[model samples]
Target: MLGPGAADVAFEVNGHPASVHVPPHHTLLDALRDELGLTGAKRVCDEGTCGACTVLVDGRPTYSCMTLAVACEGRSIETVEGLAHDGQLDPVQQAFIATDAYQCGFCTPGQIMSVVALLRANKAPTAEDVHRAVAGNLCRCGAYPGIVEAALRAARARRR
Candidate 1:
């Protein structure tokens, strides 16, 4: 168990090993953003209701703001920043761009991360599946239609 003060927490982030000293009360969102400088996961709605801080913990969608940094030790954490490789965007990210799924873009990262997790579990997801995947993420601009379309498009693109 981690003490109240700063404790060393090591884990895999975006396929790379990372270690950070954080307090027991520090959240994974804070660790990712402040310690690791991964600002892709926005800090909106720090209460975990808006899903702006959604990230993949062990390949599952988790609210980083609600998850403690110490609790994530030994887990594989995937953020939106880690989705792309070799300068190529992930299909879901590309689809989001092609479909214009974002307006202000604050929630795009979390939405994309949720869809990525969904695609990992089901390569060809139905419309309902897409809805369920991004249900936790809220687009204040009301871009749900485009977000759903982008998810379906990404699923089709992954099939090829």
Candidate 2:
């Protein structure tokens, strides 16, 4: 079932190496969801306007829906699923739950990825920084206050 221009792309995802066969036209979102079974990056907006498909590419937040799988070859891709370790939730995930940072949970993954990048660069981010970090993500449930609070809380937890 291989079509013209279909090829294999190899990349490291969530600390594991993966090679997926996809057409050159396939987006990272398509490969991650349909091929690799990494559905943490949702496909809410195929147009890339929404950050629901956000993932970390070499520690930088990227919209998977807008990025081609071939473009990610040899790069590190980290979805929300990659944030946690051996049964322990990432502080950001814990804070999101503890602070009630999400409603409906559709946009939480992208928001969390953005915050993860921000926290990596600035361990102690201000409210403004948190807001700026996730501005690309759209939350229809409108839980931004909780999101901001969670980001700050996560920062504090990281400090300890």
Candidate 3:
């Protein structure tokens, strides 16, 4: 049972119905990780500066840590876990692995999510566009070159 100030928020997650009972101030990140057991969105820099907690909300990349769970009611949330189907990774994910786009891997999920959003809109994005898309995600390992290559490769893979 939910206590005072707690409410149940129902939303679509990775095409599945998900419900979480949380207080008004509880972050979507917490609900996704704690209540829903979808931990692909990392908990780094809970303040939202780091994009490790990035998720796709209605196809737009959003920082889950900065978003309130209550605000997600009826919205669609997509995480890294949703990108794979039938044991096959999404093109973006495959590209990331092929290009070795990440190190330490803390920011990879967020970077991939951002790239996925970008690719949805522009399957033929330029390097500048890829860079712009992932600007919000910080990679301490400085893997920008590989990340950009992966984004472009993913775009190519999607086109073929």
Candidate 4:
């Protein structure tokens, strides 16, 4: 059914379809960073504890580090690279920049992805919901308040 060392596999990245020949065990993070040169999805705790590797698989936030590249067949994947439109940052990204919601900036992409998913699901999220949505993303910079504020601001902007 298998061999010790296979050549590689291929998968579509972002919206463009392509095939990459990576080892069968190579993770989506490896494929994205090494094969596709899409480094937006950071590889933090590969065990899935950290949200740094977050990406959208069909509009849903998923840990790219833990997800196998093979599992993504025929599915649309969205990364932080896709958030900008015509050189303009998405609204949540803009709010995060205005609010200074990140420091050191290592976790900002995951944070922004969480906010994007939240706003996509709830146009008006309560404070508790905002907190709950970002619970999984850990910001070592201790910028939780700013992150919350950015989320609220994004919610407001979406409503207007």
Global lDDT scores for all candidate models? 0.95, 0.94, 0.95, 0.83
The digit string of per-residue lDDT tens for model 2 on 1-160 reads 3455789899999999999999988999999999999899999979989999999999999999999998898999999999889999999999999999998999999999999999999999999999999999999999999999999999999999
lDDT string, candidate 3, 41-97, tens digits: 999889989899999999999999999898899999999999999999999999999
Q: What is the lDDT of residue 86 in candidate 1?
A: 97
lDDT for residue 79 in candidate 4, whole number 0-100: 84
What would the per-residue lDDT of candidate 1 be over residues 1-160, giving only the tens digit for each residue?
6688899999999999999999999999999999999999999989989999999999999999999999999999999999898999999999999999999999999999999999999988999999898989999999999999999999999899
Task: Name the lDDT value of residue 160 in candidate 2.
Answer: 95
Give the range where candidate 2 is weakest over 10 consecutive residues by summed lDDT: 1-10
Residue 16's lDDT in candidate 3: 95
TM-score of each: 0.98, 0.97, 0.96, 0.91
Model 3 sits at a Cα RMSD from the real structure of 1.8
TM-score of candidate 3 versus the correct structure, residues matched by position: 0.96
Candidate 4's C-alpha runs over 4 A off are 1-12
RMSD of each: 0.7, 2.0, 1.8, 1.8
What is candidate 2's TM-score against the reference?
Answer: 0.97
TM-score leader: 1
Compute the lDDT of residue 133 as modeled in candidate 3.
Answer: 95
